[model samples]
Target: MTKEAGRGHALLVGAGILCSRLFGLVRQRVFSHYFGLSDAADIFSAALRVPNFLQNLFGEGVLSASFIPVYARLLAQHKQEEADRLAGAIAAALALIIAVIVALGVLATPYLLWAIAPGYTGEKRELTILIVRILFPGTGILVWSAWCLGILNSHHKFFLSYVAPVVWNLSMILTMLFFRHRDADRLIVYLAWGTVLGCLLQFLVQLGPVLKLVPGMRLKLDLHSLHVRQVGGSFLGVAIGRGVVQISAFIDQAIATLLGSGAIAGMTTASSINLLPVSLFGMAISASELPTLSRMAGDEWSADVATKLSARLNHGLERIAFFIVPSSMAFFALGNVVVAALYQSGAFTRKDSYYVWAILAGSGVGLLASTFGRLYASTYYAMRDTRTPLRFAIVRLVFTVALGLASALLLPRALDIPLQWGAVGLTASAGVAGWIEFHLLRRKLNKRIGATGVSVAMMVKLWSAAGLAVLVACMVEHYLPLYGPIVTAIFVLSTYGMVYFGVTYLMRIKVCVEVLGKMMRRIGIGG
Candidate 1:
């Protein structure tokens, strides 16, 4: 694998994620237009998540955190054969594991759907199970696509793996467009089959690039390889951590199921939007840093090694905060506009936009903490200590479930909070738990290597600029004449961004200053 230390790789990955996320937004828009936030959409949304439990527990999160580091280290040490062998063995194992999981999931779709959404009944419940069965094999195929992502990221081929999922998104969009009136039930079934085909295509697209990086890497049942065993050890720990996280998500869905019609679909739409910033900023930087950090992990511990790790950690956090802070602000202040611009068409209404925005606002609350938490978790993996993250993930899950139950389930009735507010409660509660997780990760990281991450002043400036942006956005929203949703969004967002950058410049935010200065110089402007 190749390791490059530069902002360019991170930018490339971020740009790819940006493109993929845009396509993902389109995918959701198509769904909203065709299915709206009805029980059919609810059925599909909740069912989609059930099979993803397999993907979450066994897919990218575990493989990237565990396998990539080790594989990248082997390549750095000029042990290409060992890296190839490890990749092959892990691939073989996942193939076997995913095949079994999919088969069982297909057979047990009813139980799975019930666990995911116990409130579903009659036709809704039956439809959810049927769609889940169609989606299971596809989910299994996509889990292996995470395998492709692991291989590509190890080799600094970040762009393709991140963007390739656009194919999957497009598949769904096309299905809906073609069969937009095929009765909601049959349309959802067609949609599920489209998803399966898309997953197959998404995985195949990456195989060529992966083979280019690791030649002759055919699958081998070589669990006996020492390197394979090492990856397996790391995989088990990371998988447990991912499983707990998935359980938290599952809990949210199960609770949403009880909340009433449209709750599951509403939250699902908002969550896809919420993930945009996390994937673009958080995943981009963390993925770019992994290959380099993996090599550092293989090095002998010393004062210099510790210094390098801390410096890398701090710099990565700086980049993460810059983009994510503004994203949180936009979601909090202009979520309805955002949702309306993207999704208010056909069956989706202005009311649906507000409902989705409410959840988006709540998600914004913990956006920074959750994103920063990803870097901290990656830091632990780089240090070869997956147990700490697993431990904290368990704590986070407990907090998430408790808070989720109190706010999302109980408070809505006891306190007379609206049903929409119940969805907000779910997202906001997760944000609170995210802060707890971030705090624990930071404390452990500080104990491991003195102090790490960005300075207090930098954080304050980020919050201040974002706060200022919100006020400006509010003023714009209040004063500006109404227009079409998309146009209104463009006008407000463009103004908010200009005002934000202008204020950040005045505040002398160092990351903004430096990145913009470099852009100016690159374009032949004054120094």
Candidate 2:
């Protein structure tokens, strides 16, 4: 793929995901206004993770990592009929699977919650069960929506696939806006129903484009289809790989649940903020690059293909780092400002804001590695090698779970940290594991592609640039003229970005220089 294609498509996907995540931020604000970090919020956070398994199991990540490369290659070879058949088969299989899983999940909600969050008791447990049942069918609909996403993305229709989440986010926002009452419990019920409705709407919205791509599509059970079986086989390994990550989250929720009220909500809110940049940079870049890489991998192995793949992979890695390094710095330095600006209104007090920021800062430690690791995993996907990523993911998961337990369950008592800060410990442990994961991913790829990633010199440069940005931003946040948390944060961050871009350019950071030149040419500014 041309650098232009990779960058442009990433921008398209990024723009869509950015809007969805922005709406998601607004949704969080709505939640904060109504719920804050109450037991109700904790219930929602923990219960949401349960239904999310349905989404993650049959959702975008697995399909993107396993199904897309094969499907995209078929399209590239002009195998429209075969590709459509595979799509239909997968859809049918997913529907069947989701039907069974959802039924069992709804019925076994209490048992599932007991296992995952054993500490939840009485009303909290009851409320969590209620929400999980309400969310089950909706989560099933989302699995289908993810199937639609796989098809749309393979066709190079990136925007609608990612943007569809807006419907889901807005559903909850509207519920919080219009349906709220003095009864927070009743409001939680309304929010749960809204989630179900949004999932259906999101799925329907993507139907038009998906149907256009596969005009002759129809549901069929074809276990005999080679690609069908390949996907099924790949799905197992990929699902296990993805599941371990989910289990890590589950472990965190379970452990956090033991920490009493608001811990789960605190972690949830912090993670949502952390995911903002990851979705924009990491997921957007990988999703855009997947189709191109799949096409390249479909070709016969050659030195030419190896050279091109290595270049594209390295470029993606650097671009992700260019954005996420500063993101980590910002989170670590000015997280309180960010938390207050977005969520410190209404029931969300300043203390609560600081709590969420602590978790965010801990999560920031893994921002670069986690984002970059997604790209490296995609490289394995392109090679149709799901097993390798799974192995590495297993290793990472072991470390994460080990460190997460120590921090969440042991370290707080031992070190005399607050129980709430245990959430921070859980996140920090995961971040440390994320670096190890990325290292293994890059190492394996480099063994084949040869020295194909960010250099240590550039790593230092990125860190230095990010560190300087954080220093300036922190100082301005403290001393610069501003209105309140929101205004102060905006001013500090905008100044930080301007200073960072100017300095990176002056320091001959090619990523910033190229991006700056693009913006300048686009708006008829400096040449």
Candidate 3:
């Protein structure tokens, strides 16, 4: 794709992602109001861990990454018949697998909940199992929907896939609003059903355009196809990598469960907030750039491929550092106020805010690394070399688990840090892993693209500008009263954004200028 087209696609995806994230915040606010950081909320959130872990392992982790590129190749070769057959066979196999998994999940809900969150014993554990059983089916629906999304993405139909998450969030918000007061458990049930409904809607949203692109798209059961085998093999490694990541989460939660009642909820809530910016930039960039990268690889445009890949990677990293570094500083400075304003309305309290802030602080530190990791992983996948990332991912998992366990055992009493603080150690481990992965990926890209064309000086300027922006933001936050939490957060964010952009412009960073120029053009203000 041309640079302009790529930017346009990224913009659209970014806009859709922003919408989904905003609605998701609204949903979280509603949940906080109804349940606070109470045991009920913790149970509901904890119950989701196993199911979501499975979805990540199969859906986003393996299936989308492995399947989309191949599907794109088939479509590009004008092999619609073969492509449709592959999709059908994959869909049928996924369906059977999902059904079996769901059955197991439902049956094993009790043991799963105990294994993940052993801190809960009587009522909390029972309620968690109940919620897990209800929500377990969502995994299967989302897996099928992910396949459809991959199909849409391969066709460059990016808008619907981006918009689908917004629909899901909206559905959950409506459920929460209607059922929150009637029965707390009613809200949980509605949320579970809403998830399944949302996945179906998400799939349907993509299916319309996909059918138009590939006529005669039918659902058939053909496990013997060669295309199916290729997808299966590619997905196997991806699944293992994803499974390891999930195991890390399980370990994190298991440690939290052993810590205290509010530990799991606090960590989950904080992590969600941290993920907002990461998902907005990191995932969006990776998703938007993947097809282009894959196409370049397919066509064997080695030099062009490397140039574009480096440009995109640098742009993504600069964006992440620019936004996340200052955001993390601000989060640590104003976390309590931010949490209180957004979540302290109903069941949530000042104490809950305190716990959540601690988690958010740690997550903030990891935000840039997490965002960078997403882009790094995408680059490796685009090159069709999943094994390298998988190897790194294994090391990451081991580091995360070791740090989490050690922190839990040693840090709480010695440092007077609570058990919830284990998340901090986990985040630091992830950040280390991200740095390692980033360097490795960079070395690999350099080897392929040659050393002469690299742009080290530009990145240095970008990082310098980011540092200056953050310094200004810290000063502003310190001097300004900003009245309430809501006002303070808004003012701090606005000031930080303006200062960051202004400094980047003064530095004349190319990526910043390019992004700003696009924004100006979109607003009809550019020449």
Candidate 4:
């Protein structure tokens, strides 16, 4: 593909993901309005994580790594029949496995809660168990939704698949909106049911598109195909790697359980904001690049594969840094404004916003690393080398566990600080671990692909632009009279974005120029 096409694909994915993420934020805002940092909020957050464990293990990251390369290769080779069979077999197999797991998970909710939220006792513990059971089956359905995503993404139908989650978020938002008057405990249970319905809606919305794309698809577990076996083989390594990453998240949540009532909920809220850029820029670019990268891996590019791969990889890295640098800075420098804008209302207080901002600030420590790391990992997956990422993920888990324990459990007491501040520690320590894993992945990939990454000068330029943007945004925030959070965010963030892009445009950055050109064309101001 040409450079222009690649950027266009990334933009489509970003636009779709942005829509889904916006609705998700809206969902969270509604939830925060009703639930805030109450014990009920903690219970709902913890319960949600239990079932999401299954989704994460079986969902986008795992499927993209294991299935997309093989399936996309078949499509590239014009072997549509084989690709259809592979997709059918994998979907059927996943459905069967997830069914059994969801059943077992429902039965094991009491036991699972022991690890996920050991600090909860009596009513809190019982309520979490009930909600976890309520949520498990829905997550199973969402795993099927992810299967649809793999198919849609491989077919280059990027927008609908990414935007499908808007329905899910809308479902929950509507549920909360309808039942806003209920007590927190009852409302949360209703929200869980809404989530289940939303999950089903999310799956159905994507299924029609997937079916049209794969008209020859037949659902059966035909494990005999070589491509099928290859995907399964790759799946194991990627699953383990994804599981390692999820384990770090679970461990952090588990530790948060001990930090008092609001820590888990606060971290979840902060994470929602922290993940926006990761999904919008990092995931968007990486997801769009995967199939293209896989297609490039074929015999057509046998000669000069290294040259092409290195060029594409470096370009991806540069694109990721351009947006991510400012995003990370915003989280560190003006996170409270963001947190307030998105989440502060009703039951959620200004103090709550500050608390979440602290965690977002910690998250900023490795935001760029994590985003860059994702594209690197995607490159590894495109090469069909999954074990390297698995090994590095395990190393990250180790650091996360060790540092997480020290920072979250011990450091607060040592510093004579409130226990809740430990939630910030949890995020910051994880960021450090993310950087470590990033370096390892980049170092190894460089040896194989010949030194692929954003250049030193590009880094200097992006970071300098981001720093100035943050300064301008901060000044605007300080001088502007407090309108409501939303209006304030509009002005402050808009200024920040315009300054960043304007400065980069002045610096002759290619992406800024292209982006501005696209905008001007959309407005009929440019040819």
Candidate 5:
């Protein structure tokens, strides 16, 4: 693809992702307003956890990481037959695996609920079991959707792929609104079914273009293909890594369950809020860059691949820093107002906002680190070096376990802090783990591709902009009542953005220049 095409693709994806994230924030507001850190919300969030965890482990996390690179390589080499065969084989295997897992989840709902949230013994546990069963089949739908998306991405049909999540979010919002008045607890079950429905739609939407690109695309079971084996190994590694990450969350939820009825819900809501920026900017860039990196790798253009990958990485980091840093600072400075504006209606109370904001602030510290880690980890995958990331992921998992244990056994007494801060420890652990992973990936890339593959100067400028934005945001927060939380949020965001852009441009940051140049060309204002 030409640079123009790449920039267009990234813009389309970035814009779509921002829309999806906006809808997601609205969904969270709905949840917060109706549930308000209650037992019902806690049970619902906990129940959704297992299915969502499995979806990530088997569907998005493993399948996309494993399938995209190999599929891209096969398409590049004109091995369409092999790519189709491999896709069919993997899809068939995933079908069987998802089926068995769903069955097991249904049968073991009692035991699974017990192991994950042992503190819930009465109605909460029963409701959780029912909700988990309702959501379990969503894993199957999502797995199929991931396979379809992998095919579409490999074919460089990215627009619809980016739009699919918006569809999913919109459907869930509609479902929640439809059922909000009738037993809000039961609405979660409806949301789960909506998830399945959304996945089906997402999969079918991408199928037309994929079939056009790979004329021989078929749904068949062929387990003996050699290419399937290669994809399978990468898939297994990714599954392990993703499973470890999920385990960390599981541990936190279990610990929170023991603390209080609303603890799990509070932490989950805060986490969902924190993940918004990460998904919009970090994951969007990683997804957009993967195909390009795979094509570069397939062509044996290591120098060009390294340069392009580093440029994209630096750009992603700067963009994320530009937005996330100020957002984080604003959340910390105006935690209550932000929460009140978004989620203070219905059952949500001032107390609940305070607790949730505390969790959000803790999560914000880790958010940037984790986002950067995702960008760096993709570099390793683009180089076809999954083993190194796997090793780093294992070490990160160890840190999670150690930190979880510390939080469970020693943290409460040693710090004299309340139990609600349990998630705080988990977030800190993840932040530390992300920092380690970034440094390791950076060192490895430097060794393999030389020092130029890392962009130190651009990062310095990004950090400078972030620091200035924070200072400006703090001043705005102090001086402005703005009369409303939404208005204040807008003021803070717009002010930070203007200052950040103006300063970065004055400093002549190359990435800013490139982004502005692209914008100018798009507007037919400059060549």
Candidate 6:
């Protein structure tokens, strides 16, 4: 794809994701208003993790890595008949698997709480089990929705797949609003039922577009087909990689449970805020580039092919870093403002906002590395090298587990700090692990595809400008008598954004200049 085409597609993906994420934030804000850091909040958080495991395992990342490349390449070769068969086979097989998994998950909910939320007891544990069972079928439906995403993305239909989640978020939001007067335990059960309904709606919305794209689609098991086998092979590796990552997340939650009452809920809330940039920029660029990269793959690794791939990868890295740099800085310096703005009403207190801010700040440590690692992983997927990423992911998980234990369990007590601070340690340690994984992925890919990454000088410029923006925003917050979270965030964060764009424009960063110029022209201010 041309650079302009690639940027345009990435922007489309970003717009869709932004809409979904904004609604998701609204959902979380409503959730906080109802439950805050109470026991009910912790139960919901823990229960949701169980079903999310199913979705993450069989969902977007897994499908993108394993399904998209092979399927997209068939389309690039104009083999629509074969592509349809491949899609049909995978869809049939995925449905069968999801049905079995959901049934077993519901039956095993009591058992799962032992591993996932070992700290809970009596009523809390029983309620968690109930919620997990209620959510299992819904999460299975979401896994099916991911299959739709793979089909849509391979056909280069980006927006609807990403935006479909808005319905899912809206369902939960409205459920909470309708039952806002109810107690937490009963209201949460209603929310789970709402999630299930939303899951169906999310899939139905995508099914229409998918059917249009693949009119010849038919459902059948075709394990005998070579392309089907290829997808299966890649699927296993990606699944294992995704499983390792999930285990790491679960371990974090398990550790959080040991920390204290509010720890799990606090971490979950912080993670919601932390994931914004990752979903918006990291996932967007990678998702947009995957098909183009897959289509560009040559039969042989010739110099021309390597150079083309490296050029695309480097440009993607640059785009991610430009946005993520400022996001990381803002999280580190002004996270409390962000947390307050998004989720500090009703039961969520000023104290809870600060607690989440600490975790968000810790998350900023490896934001750039983690985002860059995602693009690098996508490049590997495009090259049909799924195992390399799986290996690196396992390594990252080990570091995460080891470092996480030390930082979260031991460090706080050693420092004579409150145990609640252990949650921040968990995020910071995970950030360190993310950097390690990123280094390995980049180093290995560079050897295979030649040198590819954002330039050091480019990073220096981004960081410098972002640092200045944060400094100015902080100074403004300090000097001005900001009254409320919404007003303060609007004024201060807007100032930070303006300063970052102004500095980058003055520095003649190509992307920044182009974006600013476009904005100016739209407003009738520039040539």
Report the C-alpha lDDT of model 1 over 1-527, residue by residue, as the tens digit. Answer: 23234487888899889988999999999899988999899999998999888888888888999999889888888889888888888899998998888898899888777778899999889888889999999999988999999999888888999999999999999998999879999999999999999999999999988888888577887877888887888899999999999999999999999889999999999989999999988989888888787777575777777777888888889989988999998998889889999999999999999999999999998999999999889888987789999999999999999999999878888887776479899999999999999999999888777689789998889889888887888888888898889988898888888887888888888778877787799999977
Q: Model 4: per-residue lDDT, tens digit, 288-407? A: 999898877664445389778889988988888888999999999989889999999999999999999999999999999999999899888988899999999999999999999999
lDDT of 3 by residue, 1-527 (tens): 77667666777777777887887788888888887777777787888787887689779647767887777788888898888888877877888888988999899887777678878898777877877887778766777768877887787777777777877777778877777667776677677777667766666766667667667666777767777777787788778878877887788888878876677777777776777777777777778777776676674666776777777666556655555555666567667756877776778787888878877876665566667677677766777777877787787777777777776657777888766666666555555656665566566656765442225675566556656766676677688875866776677667767877888788886656887887899899969
Model 4 is weakest, by summed lDDT over 10 consecutive residues, at 295-304
Q: What TM-score number comes out for model 6?
A: 0.99
CA-RMSD of model 5 = 2.7
Q: Which stretches of candidate 2 lie over 4 Å from their true place?
A: none
Judged by TM-score relative to the true structure, which candidate is superior, 2 or 5? Answer: 2
Candidate 1 runs further than 4 Å off: 1-4, 521-527
The runs of at least 3 residues in candidate 4 whose Cα sits more than 4 Å from the true structure, single-residue gaps closed, are: 299-303
* Clash count in backbone of candidate 6: 0
Candidate 2 vs 3: which has more lDDT: 2
lDDT of 5: 0.74
The C-alpha RMSD in Å for every predicted model, in order, reads: 1.6, 1.2, 2.7, 1.2, 2.7, 1.0
| CA lDDT, every model vs. true structure | 0.89, 0.89, 0.73, 0.92, 0.74, 0.92
Model 5 lDDT at residue 486: 73
TM-score of each: 0.97, 0.98, 0.92, 0.98, 0.91, 0.99
Model 1: per-residue Cα lDDT at residue 492 = 84
- Tens-digit lDDT track of model 5 for 1-527: 66566666666767767776777778788877778888888887888787887788887656778889888889888998888888777877888888998898789889887779988988778878888888788656877777877887777766677677777777777888888887876777787788677767767777677678767756687757767777887888778877877776787777778876678887787777777778767777777777777676664756776676666656556665655655666556556656767776678887887877877776776676677777777766767677887777777777767777676546866888876667666666666666676677677877666552335676667667767876787698789976676777677767877787778888987656777777789899976
RMSD of 6: 1.0
